[model samples]
Target: MTIKEFKLPDVGEGVAEGELVSWLVAPGDRVEEDQPVAEVETDKALVEVPSSYDGVVEELFAEEGQMVPVGDVIISFRVDEEGDGGGGATATDAEPADAQPDSPASDGSEPEPDAGEAGDDGADAEPDTPSGRTFAPPSARRLARELGVDVAAVDGSGPGGRVTEADVRAHAEGDAGSADADAADAPEPRPAPTPTDTGSDGRKSAVSKRDAGGSAASSATAAGGPEPAGRETTLATPATRKVARDRGVDLDDVPTDETRDGEAFVTADHVRAYADAVESAAEPTPEPGPTDDAPEPAPAGGAPETATASEATTASGDETVPYRGVRRTIGKQMERSKFTAPHVTHHDTAEVDSLVDAREDLKPTAEAEGVKLTYMPFVMKAIVAGLKRHPYLNSELREDDEEIVLKGDYNLGIAVATDAGLMVPVVESVDEKGLFELAEEVNDLAARARERKLKPAEMKGGTFTITNFGAIGGEYATPIINYPETAILGLGAIEERPVVRDGEVVPAPTLPLSLSIDHRVVDGAIAAEFANTVMEHLENPLLLLNE
Candidate 1:
């Protein structure tokens, strides 16, 4: 038997690292080749990492939630050397056996805490002696720095006594509160304090009072801003940090509701939200008019009404939700596309009376064949025709190469809104497929996407995209360009509207279309021409049969 170490493969193009979401196979489990051993979440998608050799699982080197770089040893297996010839079950990019693994485990159990990872309740060492190094996730450390809490003094409640963000917050508001109160009181003597305002009040006010005593407090302090160099402890992506520097905004001052591992994580949206809030607050407020609604006055005797549970929860503070995984990935992609490409949307209405009639006629035929037909297949056909006419619209701009690469194949991405976020599953070779074929594939892909069962490959390699906002009852929307792709088509609800025909106004069924193009690569004239070609096909449904 030979022991083989398997390195984490590069699951996506240009991906540098991935988060270990979970382990599908554990130690001592026998697995076959191509069997998924672990699930990893990359910036692109969530993918299952498969095993290369059939063998018994020996060890797992990474813990869940840990970010692992590509080419790092992740697992080990023991296989018969003679059964697989001289291949020996070693991964192509496997590291040396002597190389140190990340959070390596001897058995199917959590790794022991090292000096650097030591938490509270140091049973391994003397109680009086300091561990010297406080162990925590990056987020917890960032929170400690932000709240001015001494993490070493915080009693950890996490596994192995690791300090968490909650621990830091509690320590700052509870344990360190007396010290803060003493410091605040040292500046000025206070008269006899009320019993109601002694313990909890002093502790709770510790965080708020620091802000109140600081310059401009929250927004004003932020408006004045700090140096362009943001705080070292602030957690944000490289792109977000760059945006902060470009906007001359202090990242530390920009508030966020998202946290990672007990640290406040800032996104570009958070930065923009803060800026918008500041701008809105700075605007002048108009005097209330007689018709304006005002809050009801308190009852007599200067007393207020008792609040309900829901109201009390609302009054406490805004809830903090972690922004990560698929939603965060979607946000980053949208942001990149919006900022990188100059977009121009051309809106028009198509008289689809014939198209509607044609679909109705074919409905029975489709139903008999066990196929559910939708307007999307017809629209997809029309879009393919339009792309064939205007090849520039079916292309991508390679900025580094300074070239416009026109795609030969027509693969369309259908944007399906899932509970996690908006996911676009690609339907390959749309031009080659018939209406029935397209309809079946679209329905299957959409269903799987909503359930999050679609593989990573099904979500990539789209030449163009079609989003049906009409399904949700929208008439028109300036849809953002799907990055890399030169254009995207948004469909609006089809309804009967008054139209002019033969010099007479009559009601006709019309479909609203909004085509957004990358202005940098596609010209306005070309975009309009493409849209017109699409409408021409829809106006005459027979033309689509020829497709």
Candidate 2:
């Protein structure tokens, strides 16, 4: 059999490496060519890595959390013959497929972490460690360290004598203050701590067992160790732990949302909801005693009290959204841009009464050309005119070569906001495209970008970026430069505002604009000149026609 090693391709231009998010097909799994073998997250987007050869998967070279560089061998495929490899594995210039099947791939849907993933993500289930400790998940080990509890002293509550998250919490709390301590002190009746029944506080867990879908058992009963049958353990995820910690809520006290394998599971939502309820209940509400004619309804157990937001809607509240794929990528890119570029923002207002009227005049002409003309087309034209004069703003400083590279071609990056994150789809050779062409392309690109159908190539080779923040109702921001590019322009809402015309105040359509430039490549004078020239073109649509 011929073993073929498939290297991770450079999914996008200039992307050095990508994080191995998950393996879609594990070793020994049969797969066809182009069937995605793994999911990788680049700095720009989360993409699937398809198998280039049709064969059985031999080895997976990269772990889920490891960052593999471009051209690095990620997987090996074993084929029966030397030349009979290729079948259907080809990546074309089309919209990328969704990454992790469970994960919606940056579509703003945050799914719960799978129990299997949790093992690798937090559980350090290695048989032995350098610290001479038994197997436990990383989270449980961390909690043990935090509470000054020795893992060696605590009993394992997980399957196969594995240490669990709750085992450590209960150990640290002293397991009902320890039986010896109870004997030494006052003889107060206290329940002995059991892996299956007691909570972190060392009490018979008060969390309802009915919520735990399984018969009064535990979440990890499938692993099967020595856990009791009727007792249920309180289970909280890492995110829930953080929320409980921040709010000073006991993990044991937070009511269970559900039970996984008889273990009462409390999620981050459960903690937040419980905290909100507690806080709301603490507030003093003045209530007039039951009126003579009408009396307030009472529950079978007690009197009716004020309704808390949590009680009314248990699901509505703060959520712990994990920054994993594209959303995390955007954050890192923004941080790099903000920190690397010495930013200088200049805000200005342009009276665009004539430009608005010009768009209205050419609406029919644009429609006849199969394009719906918008102010963005006029803005693009005006930007190109300004860039032609102030070429420095449309250039980059090659720090590696220690020289300035002025781009002759105007490739504009139009920042489109989507539910996932802020994405910029590039429009190449803007100077060559007419108003109708620009309008159609912009419309197409924006629509596709929102739907996440734009290819990686469509987002590349940008000379300058323009973001229409006004569309989302905002004005004047220190827009971060799209890295490697020298400047970014921000457009605010174009609304009717009072402006001075011929020494007299009059209501006119005004557009607010903000420009952010990289001080290392662009001087204040050049930035000011570019801003003013762009505004001039915007104010007088005829100026763009002349250009």
Candidate 3:
């Protein structure tokens, strides 16, 4: 049999190590090429490692929860003599210099058997001796000994009648322990209960002895029976329950009304009603003091003593939610970006009245071409035009070498907000695509991103980013720079406002722009100049078409 070793692949984003979360295939199982063999959790994300060759799993090298360095063998496989080109070979047959006995083969197979197992001769060996036991894998035997059990006494339960640790533990508790313990301390076996036949009985059922009572005791307790009292009960939803936990309110302590049907449940409305009643009942009133006992006078030019309330008020209308998945990922990324990037934001408002006219003029032609026109296309086109003039903004800084690497092509990243999180998909070579084409590409990318269908490569390698928060009604925001990029631009709500045109007040379309740039690569002057150039294109939209 040929054995092949499978080393851990370097999951991109420069990960050095990954934790083995789970193994989908165990030793002695058959696996196919390109089949996922194990799931690994890296610092960036969780990825599954697929088998490179088709073979029988001979051994698993890494245990679940173990952290494996990149390039380390994680599994091994044994293949047929024809070899299947999957690199299946036994460790004993052609052992690698760094091959550990438990290391995974590149072909996802098991290692060669140990010398003792290979040399053992078939015979009717002693039941108490370890050699007499059916072959147990190293891990199984180790676990058996750790649990203080004899493998030979255990029944074989695994494949090929292998004695597993579970079998050893079961036998030890069931039979072996009983024989080893002192006779007086042994557990007493219980006697089976006697059964009575209940056939064709037309008489009343008999009651248990514990339930029988005399009339005198019933009469006495009847006079002292517990009394029922009226009390208010509250209801709450799952979301409210979570909020109560965060606010230190005990749900059990909160009175709840019993339901007549199905399960007893609480509603959010009931909880709110109880909270309101408590607040109304606890309202405070002002008190008047004696006229002679006047309050102390304030000193000249001194501030008055403020009455600080010690207790905090409970939240009334707000709901609490746990951070998870993509939202959690976004939170971590924002935290890192905000702290790592020394952000310096510069804001400016630009008049886009002419740009609006220009878009209106192109709307008919764009419709004829079966494409929807939007302000984003104009913004992106302007940004790309400006980036070409100010190339520093379209670049990343390498901190390790303290050098700035300017990019030749413009991979514009359009920031899209989805239910999952904020995703940025690159629009490659924006300088080459016209306004209508760029708009279509942006629309396609945004739709795919929201659907979570954007490939890893599509979301990577962005040289600059634009976040149009105006779509959601934000006036202006200092957007965080999508790092390694040096800069990110924020487009605010475009509204028609009165402007001075030829010394006369006239309504004009205005757009608010906020530029956040990395000070490490571009200075304030350069960033401002780039923003100004972008504004110039937006003001004179004809320039975009000419370029």
Candidate 4:
């Protein structure tokens, strides 16, 4: 069998990297050529990456939420050199450096005794695997690390005895129960330690718990302390240390079962279990009635003590979410566009009584052909006409080359708001397509964009962009230009308003327009002229037909 590595392919024109959102196929699963193996999120859109070889998946190199550069290997496949390559892959002379040979259960074959199971004299021998690592997927392993459980000690309940997330959680809970039982069987607890410091104000500060040491008796004594201090010497992974700090648990107070280099090895699970037990033991018992033992209530008008930062932090429940993927991509793009170019926005209103009538007349015809027609198609047609008259508005600024390239073809990007983030899917050759055709393409692109089914290429190569904030009942927004493109048009809700025509006041439908341009490329005067041209087409539908 030949092991072939699959690198992340370039999904768009200028995409240099992508985030591996998820894997569609797992290791050992059979896949055919051109079958989708993973979903990758590029700057433009989310795309499904397909496999290149017909084989069984061997291993995954990139984890979900990790950014992978183009041409970097993300996965590997094991292919049979001779035969149809339809069945599960068998063992070969060559093996991946990071992966071990599959066992009989993984290959769907009969089990056989391992060389380490017995010696020539029929005595037990050493194990085949020296690393002592357990079998589990990346997600399961991540869960184990988060829960501070040693996955190697957990019993796997999946195929080939693979440890799953549920298994890890179960093992952690069981370990916690065992710890509790052992604590219950210990001797009676000792008295609380004396306060070691007194302030000028006569307030007594409790001794720090971190110096209490690592014995079970010490842990029980320190559980009632006010503050936990850092340990003098604690051996733990960085992740475990972080978990301990987050839970306000001191490493010195947490008991451990394993040791490395003659030092107590602590895991996140140990810290968590210790924290839970301490919390349970620290619950205050309710007093049924007032007694001399209960402290006197604070004086009626006495001043209250100010809370410390740590106390306030614990009182307020705060949460943290990871900032990555599509949201981060949009933020970077917007920042670059805002800082790289000086933007100018021009606001205006157009009386689109004719445009409204034109769309209403064509709605029935569009519906007969199964197309959902909206005002966007008319606006797109009018925008294209305006671009033809003012070429600079539909151009790109090539700063490195110090030149402005006027695009002859009109490819307009439509800004779509999706649950993931804001995505712009470009409609190619807008000038050549008719009203119905434009509406159909726009609807299809918007639908796919929301469903995250759009390909990267479908969002690229736009000379101009249009955002209809009106669909959300917004008006006159100063939109940022899609970088490299010189301009973007924002459309607002079309509503009936008072207008004076032929020296008379009357109610007429008006459309609000806000056009933003890169001041480096198009002058203010030129931008105003382009806006005028677009408004003219909207006011007189015949002008659009003439185009």
Highest TM-score: give the candidate number.
Answer: 4
Model 3: weakest 10-residue lDDT segment is 191-200
- Mind giving the per-residue lDDT tens digits that candidate 1 earns over 350-371? 9999999999999999999999
Better of 1 and 2 by TM-score: 1
Candidate 1 regions exceeding 4 Å error are: 7-17, 42-45, 68-73, 83-315, 502-506
Q: What is the TM-score of each candidate against the true structure?
A: 0.56, 0.55, 0.49, 0.63
Give the Cα error of residue 146 in candidate 4, in Å.
Answer: 14
Candidate 3 lDDT over 360-477, as tens digits, reads: 9999999999888898888888898888889989888888888899999888888887754566778988888898998788889888878655654676677899999999898789
lDDT of 4 by residue, 391-453 (tens): 999998888899999998899999998877778899999888898999999999999999877
Native-vs-model 3 lDDT? 0.60
Model 3 residue 260 CA deviation in Å: 42
Please say which candidate is ahead in TM-score: 3 or 4: 4
Each prediction's whole-model lDDT (CA):
0.66, 0.64, 0.60, 0.69
TM-score of 4: 0.63
Winner by lDDT: 4
Query: Best to worst by TM-score, what's the order?
Result: 4, 1, 2, 3
